[model samples]
Target: MMRKIENALAVALIAIVAVLPLFLKFMQGVCRVQVPGADIAVLHFVFLFASVAGLVTWREDRHLSLASLSSVFGEKIRRPIESVKTGGASCILSALFINAFCQLVNPAQFDARFWGMSVRFFFASLPLCYFGIIAMISCKKGNLIASLIGMVFGLFISMGPFTGILYYLFGMENVPSLYAINDAWLSFSKIALLPIIVIFSSLAFFGMPLFLVLGGIAYVLFSAGGGYVDVIPLETYRILTDRNIAAIPLFTIAGYILSQSSAGSRYVAVFKSLIGPFRGGTVIAAVIVSTFFSTFTGVSGITILALGPLLAVVLTGSGYSKDRAESLVTASGAIGLLFPPSAAIIMYATVNYFSIDVFDLFKGAIIPGCIMALSMMATGVVLDKRGERPKFSGKEARDAVLHCIPELLMPAFISVLYFKGVFDLFEAAAFAVIYAFCLSVFVRRDFTLKKSARVVASSVPVSGGVLFILGAASGISYFMLDANVPAILSGFITQYVKNPYVFLILMNLVLLVVGCLMDMFSAILIVSPLLLPLAESFGVSAVRAAVIFLMNLSIGFLTPPVGMDLFISSYTFDKPLSRVVKGILPFLIVQFAVLMLVTYVPFFTEAFL
Candidate 1:
């Protein structure tokens, strides 16, 4: 089946991506031999890895999208809407596929080959992968007519590229009629672009994949504005090939490997042994472990779901109330976003590259990140005020620390290698992957080959999904830039919200709402461009603004109603949503206080800088 093939390809690609970096590092570091075009090869593999993984994610129905409306509606009513969304997605992807193919055959496009693979192969693979997606959609939904209808619309959207292919195969003079039809379609698309975007915006709530929703809007905006829709794919290619962007997948895999191994338990043991004698020591361990896990994974939901139960037991056994423990665990999930090597900060800098420096943002985040983490721990301690606690054993502490030293040394390894200029961001990420692999597989020997495969199978989809959204959202950001939306927004903000302090407060409120609605990755991609300029207009430094943006979204994970952590914690603990919400209330208040301090004071985030 196509599904199985996609999954297999995803796993293989991820394995290669994981190993390729380590090999390259060895060639550079150990052998003192640099591989020519090594960076290019890594970026290409990352691209292929992301593409294949994204398709697998789609096949698995795991692409991130808002589906609250689907939950609200019954299956009978929701089924039709889902079918229509699928068809719409088919249309957008089909157009993109055609566009990619046209680019492949174009005389002007890049034709260089690397590692015996034509660059055109990358372009060529797009159509096949996209067509496969289309086929899989029909196969999964059993809706052939919908796909056919969608393809026709796709042709219309891709009229420019479709006609180019015709001209390249046959002279434009001979295809005068085709050119005329293309012009007519372009005119109609121009008139219809606004309405189409509106419909896609509405469909976002109806469970449309975020990539399709974003890609659709970008494609039409480009097409109607006398720009080539094919450029959207080109832009996607450009982002995926960026020097530092590959680090996202590399670091993500590293985090996944560690999470899948026995790292969490070892960390808990170490934290407990070191702090277990103090009052509220277990609560402190729970917060520390949660923060540590989330710092690597960059996904709070994963932190809560994977380690929540274990931490719950640890906390409950230490005399903490179940409600208080659950609340602390959920709130601690995302407090690590401001820490070093955080994918969120990397993404934030990448998106706002013109203004923000990755190193500066990383440095800026440390103090604020610690404040948030410590605040959560302090709140946990306060909530669980029982005085009796276990006595510390130096021998036990030494054993626990010895066991987790490699795990603890990970942060230090990354910091020394990267900050000291021994490795680039991409190389550092690759090193983290290699380090985690060795620690998990060889050092601990707890991660078996089969488990490694399973981790690859599990983590690739997440990396793919996040990368897919990042790539697609880049198109929207491109359109916004081309439209000068950021400048316009800056002018509006300058006129309306004059006070810098007032703007910071307002920005936090807005981001909290956006966080409640959108995933952090897409939010960073689509929102940062519009926000960065406004922050600058208000005299806020880029590093400080970046920290504020990320911290707000971090706390957004714990915000009420639809905060991601609330749902994950509820499910993980088997508690009602209301109970989870009630439990997290105090931690939320604490995080909000920290957020406000970071937002207003600025020194916390700017201390290192």
Candidate 2:
């Protein structure tokens, strides 16, 4: 019953938030009237969406975490490690719940109103959902006793604020003993801060969810240093409620809607029909089609999974070797990341500490994006052993193009609408969702109502996973800024590295490792702030640094050993990991060359801006 309620509320909240921008735009432009509290409503709905969706994903065990470090071990060892990780995560969530409850019941917030609606009404979800997530995690892991003890531990640690709130609500006399306990806990936590962080870091490798790990770390740091612990949740609230952040989830839904439909096959037909007549054309078509989907899906793994099989067959049937064809598909997975309407670029501009125009960032990425895409295609062409291709069929090409015209026009539609001032970024994203919905459900009739709901339902967990990470990462970023880590690192770097070119080389190498470790969004939020200062000290423009950062990370997806693309491609193609890595080597070399060119030659990323 509780799960049903959570799901219903999550879907309703997501639906409302998803349509708000389009609804608000319709009112302003078509209805010619302002909507009261429109901005506040949108922001709060995003908050609710983030929390509820996160809670739902948490319940579903869909939140992102590193693969369990104990996966290779026996159950005897792995089970205990997993139990400890779950207990730690539950305690962290419990602490967060207590923190949010204090914020919720604050005397100042009781009278807060957005137009006629009480803000506390929405704020109520924060604590409720956090508590719910904790309960769900404990139950699923079969660690109820351990999690309960951890919850008690969390409350003990937070006793200073927790008891203070209770005293106000109950009009109790001063509790000297409770305050003493709080003080003692704080003293111990402060003294053992490094050990606690080390334990938590180890849990992260053991598969504690990333948000909980980061949030837990921030919670400890603040409490030990006598900083406000409530600010941790506030940082989450701030990042999730930002105007541009809305687009991440919105575009995410749009991407999933199209991917879940028949659009992939249609677009594949269009690309193949247009290019299949020439030598090496099948490989080129594979690259284009993969790039097109990656631009929408934002995660290249999805692109590889959705279209990898069909394209592999297409390439193999067209006479190319399976390994090379599969590698080309994997290599193309991360290419279109630098294109317009890319969620990564939007996220970079949004989270970047130094001021950056998203438009300028997108502009800067175009030539580099084209270079990466063209280079992959050219490499495939050079490596091809396929001889003369079939002659072009005008009728076949026309029909294929006509069939997928809506999919083909999607990028152009979004760009023109956003760039021409027809819609702001959020509205553009909202329009993309609505447009994809219409194409897939109404026009193409690819999804029934029930299926459409399921597709949107599936997307919520992914959106929640990404949004939750961004929110928690902001807390870590906040702690870093408060500690002045960036300035310290920047000063240290400038003193040692006398040449800008040398700094660029080291930055590139650092980002490649970082990219292999975390998702692009989290990397952008957590690392960009630290690096931007260093880049500025070396005279690299913010736009150039961003391009360099994104370009390197894109290639990082193709890096060997543990590159995400290698794993996904191996899974999709049912090939050994070694073979997948070997298959991508040629394309990886080509991308490395392009990366070096983009790093040193600024014109490709800078000329458009």
Candidate 3:
């Protein structure tokens, strides 16, 4: 019965919204109303009234006990009452006096000032929306009612008048001085509300679909009756040049195709054959294979899936335990995220407004990548030392190398292109795709047209997912700039940390925390604009700063709570997320430590530059 009611309500709501424009137009034509913005004004008022009523009802139902007010009274009830009455009466009297003074001084001024109430109401309602959602999710009583209240608040807060005030304040000259105001506003809207969305979506199961519908509605309303709100001047050549973004999808496709080819399997097989003879050898093999694959694919999920089954086979065949095999596979999987040709690296470079030569980024990453790989290998050696070591015959070793040669050549081909500069990212990626196709069709005979098409089709969703997030983040970026977020942040940072090193450390800490919660791409896109100017002020190279920022955010994939890679690893290993997290701990530590080094020691990135 409840389900049927909910569905009926949803359908009715959709129908009403769809027919609203026509209904309003008809009413206006028949009545001949002279109001220029009546539609927008009515929409705002309805939302505002709904939001206030819902919030008040919600708070009344969840009212705190009178005993809970004892702390404020402290055994002096009369005094507390006296204080409340006095404060309230004084506020009301003061408001009246101010209105009287304004009317006497200048009636036009008073009317203009009073008209600004709509803007103030709009701003005040934003926090109410956010808090209502948080309360809905976290509080125990009547989540549905609380959510409804939140929805009302969101509708009101997102109305035209509020948006207009936001545009005005943020659009002012010298608005950068109000970075704190911008930051605080964004913290409430973007940061706070986003987590609430995540929590509700995860917990309610049905919540995500509803959230998506609400989001679509909100977007439509916000964009309605728009008369060219030019928040940022578009860069002419920069926006038109698809070349800048071409590398992103091309590299993504190359990685996908490489994973689908025999190269991926062969690379896994060779590592197992070569290292299968020693104690913990299979684990070591997994690490080596992960490292090699990272050079070509630079994706942790693909690397893990490619090597996982083979590593499991080798480990079990060598008499190692399942627990040990799972640990090795999980840790090795994490290495690809930190290695070269990583999509995360591409995103970071783009967001920071500097191009990172894939070769330089790749070469610079080698040492740090090795540090992580070696750390995992060392951990495996200690963990699986007691297992029996299998010995392979000379023929077996020879065959392993022969089988692996073709797969091994792909990374070599990529490195050669990087060094020759024949393909500056986009061209190289196109070349790689062609090479992979040729290798699969003629040389390897493993890739069929059907299979190739399937592989290419599968990559679309992955690429689309990243691109969609980038677009949404662009909207959020527009909002932040409109609020003068960057200027306010710059002022705060300059006040406390004048020294470059201290500023770098502070930025690192901030990135580290942000990374743990958000995906690397979104984090870089949202954060780089704010932090890049600070880095420039401190005499830091934009390229180096970008690299460091990316490297730190990449670690988020391995951390808990929101780690996308960690979830992938858990699925690959068929282990609980907690277990996978535990296995990747050592690698996480090593990667974060390396991030600190790369951030402070500019020479690490500068050597090739």
User: On lDDT, who's better, 1 or 2?
Assistant: 2
Cα lDDT for residue 482, model 1? 82
| Worst 10-residue lDDT window, candidate 2 | 106-115
Best by TM-score: 2
> What's the residue-level lDDT of 537 in candidate 1?
85
lDDT of 3 by residue, 281-302 (tens): 6677778876665545545656
RMSD each, Å: 2.1, 1.9, 16.7
What TM-score fits each model?
0.95, 0.96, 0.61
Q: Write the per-residue lDDT of candidate 2 for residues 1-609, one digit (tens) a residue.
A: 877776677667767876887888889899998998897788788888888888878877878776567978998998788778767877888888888887777776546577688878777877887887887767774788778878988888888668757866886658888888888977988999999999987887777888888888888888887847878867877787788888888887888888888988888788788888877787888888888778877778878887888888998888888887888898899887888778899999998735788989999999999999999889978887766678899999999999888888987899899999898888888888888888998999999877787788777888898888888888888888888999999999899999999999999999998777777887898899899889988889899999999988888877876677887898899998899988888888889899999999989878987
Q: State the C-alpha lDDT per candidate.
A: 0.82, 0.84, 0.53
> Highest lDDT: which candidate?
2
Task: Give candidate 1's whole-model lDDT.
Answer: 0.82
What's the C-alpha lDDT at position 393 in model 3? Answer: 69
- Top-down TM-score ranking: 2, 1, 3
